[model samples]
Target: MKPEDFQFMSTMLKQRSGLVLNEDKAYLLESRLMPVSRAHNIKGVEELIAEIRKTNNEALIVEVTEAMTTNESFFFRDIKPFDMFKDHVLPHVLEKCAAKKSLRIWCAAASNGQEPYSLAMILKEEAAKLAGWKIEIIGTDISRQVLKKAEQGLYSQFEVQRGLPITLLVKYFDKQDDQWQIKPEIRSMVQYKYYNLLDSLTALGHFDVVFCRNVLIYFDQPTKGKVLEEISKLMPDYGMLFLGGAETVLGVSDKFAPVAGQRGVYALTGK
Candidate 1:
């Protein structure tokens, strides 16, 4: 890809999804967008760029942006965060909201449904403890294509093995041909939607716990701040926020602070 093409896509990505692609990542753009080129029947990235330049259709621009951002992810791709969710966050929320028997969890950048499905499995395992509780686990991403796959809850053997424990796999998934399909009950626990972080929060409602992990590392500072601010608005005063291992609320927003004894967990400091 040409340097100008990289810059153009980077600008478009930042504008469309708040993801900042640096110059060194020109190779990544080539790797990800090559499929977009082929899908659109273009010969190469250069041709794709020329075609993008020819269009004013907002839908066309959205397709280019979505094509660039469809990252590969699986159930509990990083184990520690889910561990934290089950051990620390779930326990806390369960105790605090016992009276209501209702809980809302959101996986903001859930790619391929793995994260939310993992949570569903955890809840299933603790069925006795959460008896009669109303659980709503919502998974949202910028890519409609990925969300559709997520909603399907089918995973290849290789895809299921990534960070998935063999015991839970056997208990929660059923074999369909060569692939594993998440059980209908577990699949129904999560609601999937196409959501761009660049957009407003009014339509997303609010959550008791929000998992916006691993996404901020790709954004510029201003975009990160804006996204975090929007996230803060969608959480309760005492809600929890989970970030990637490398991310934090420090210097990003004053709305949250790291939870004691927990690595990536943040307690709402909006108090």
Candidate 2:
């Protein structure tokens, strides 16, 4: 790809999704977008770039963004965070919200919904204790294509095998030919929407827990701060924040404090 085209797409992506693309990332773009080029019947990256410049059609923009957005995820991708949630956070929240008998959990940047569905499976196994609680699991992502797949709650065979235990799979999903479909009960437990982290969180409402993991590493510092601030706005004083193992809240925002047991889990605190 030409330097100018690379620069243009990088700028466009950063402005739209808060994801930063450096000059060294040209190869990354080429490898990821090569399939998109082939799918569009374009011979090379140059032709794809030309097509992008020729049109700003909504469909084309979505196609390109879908091609660009990272969708790498797996059920219970990291065991420790969920362990912390069940061991520390849930216990605290269940005790505090016992009178209300309700809980709200949000998985932001919920690419294809593995994180939320994993949580649903966990809750299903521990149903006895949560019998009376009103559970709301909301999953949101900036990519429309991903959000649609999340709502369907179907995973390809390869997807099911990755990071998912056989017991949980047998318990929560039904086989449908080549795909594994999350059962209706688990599917109905979560709601999904298209949400850009750059947008306001005023309509999202406060949540007891928010999983904004792994998404921020792609963003620049300013964008990271903006996302963290927006997240803090919709989180209660005691709400929890779960980030990627490689990510952190320290020096980025003061709205949260790291929880003791979990390395990446953070709890809302006075900022």
Candidate 3:
């Protein structure tokens, strides 16, 4: 890719999905977008970039963005965050929202649905306590392609193997030939939607707990702070935010502070 073309692609990705592509990652453009180029019969990535430059092709642009966006996810990607959610976060949120008997969770950059589905499985385990509660789990991602896969609730054998316990695997998933599909009960517990972190999140409404794990590392500092600030607006003082183990709110925003003993859990600042 030419310097100007790389700059154009990187700028478009940054604007569209808050993804910061540096010069070192220039090679990634060809590796990831080549399939998109072939799918559209555009010959190669350089041609694809040229075509995008010359036309206002929304579909092509969307395909390119989705191609570059990482959709790497697996069941319970990390054990620690899910453990925090089950042991500490859920209990607090349940207690705080007990009067209304309602709880809402948002999984930003939800990828292929494993994160939200993992939360659903945990909630299912505590069904007796939440028997009459109105539970809502909204899983949102920038790529509609992955969102579609998530809504289908199907996963390959390799996908189910990652970070998923055998006991819970047998309990929640039904094997359909080689692929495992989450049972309807668990599948119905979560909803998937296409959302960009760069866009306004107000329409998503309030969430008692949010799992925005493994996402912000791709963003620059300003974008990270802006996204965190916006997320803070959707939660109450008692609401919690779960970021990736590598991500933190410390220098990025004043809206949240780390939970006393938790590594990846954070509570609203003034709380």
Query: Per-residue lDDT for 19-89 in model 2, tens only?
Result: 88888877877887788889878887777877888886667666777778898999998888888888888
Better of 1 and 3 by lDDT: 3
For candidate 3, the C-alpha RMSD (Å) to the true structure equals 1.1
Ranking of predictions according to lDDT: 3, 2, 1
Backbone steric clashes in candidate 1, count: 0
lDDT of each: 0.86, 0.87, 0.92
* lDDT: worst 10-residue window of model 2: 56-65
**Number of the top candidate by TM-score?**
3
Q: Model 1 over residues 129-242: C-alpha lDDT tens digits? A: 998999999999998878888999999999999989999898899999999999998999999988888889769887989988889988877778888888888887768999
lDDT of 1 at 240: 92
Candidate 3 TM-score to native: 0.98
Q: In each prediction, how many residue pairs overlap at the backbone (N, C-alpha, C within less than 3 A)?
A: 0, 0, 0
lDDT of 3 at 95: 96
Location of the lowest summed lDDT over 10 successive residues in candidate 3: 262-271
Which pairs clash inside model 2? none
Give each model a TM-score: 0.95, 0.95, 0.98
Model 2 residue 261 CA deviation in Å: 2.4
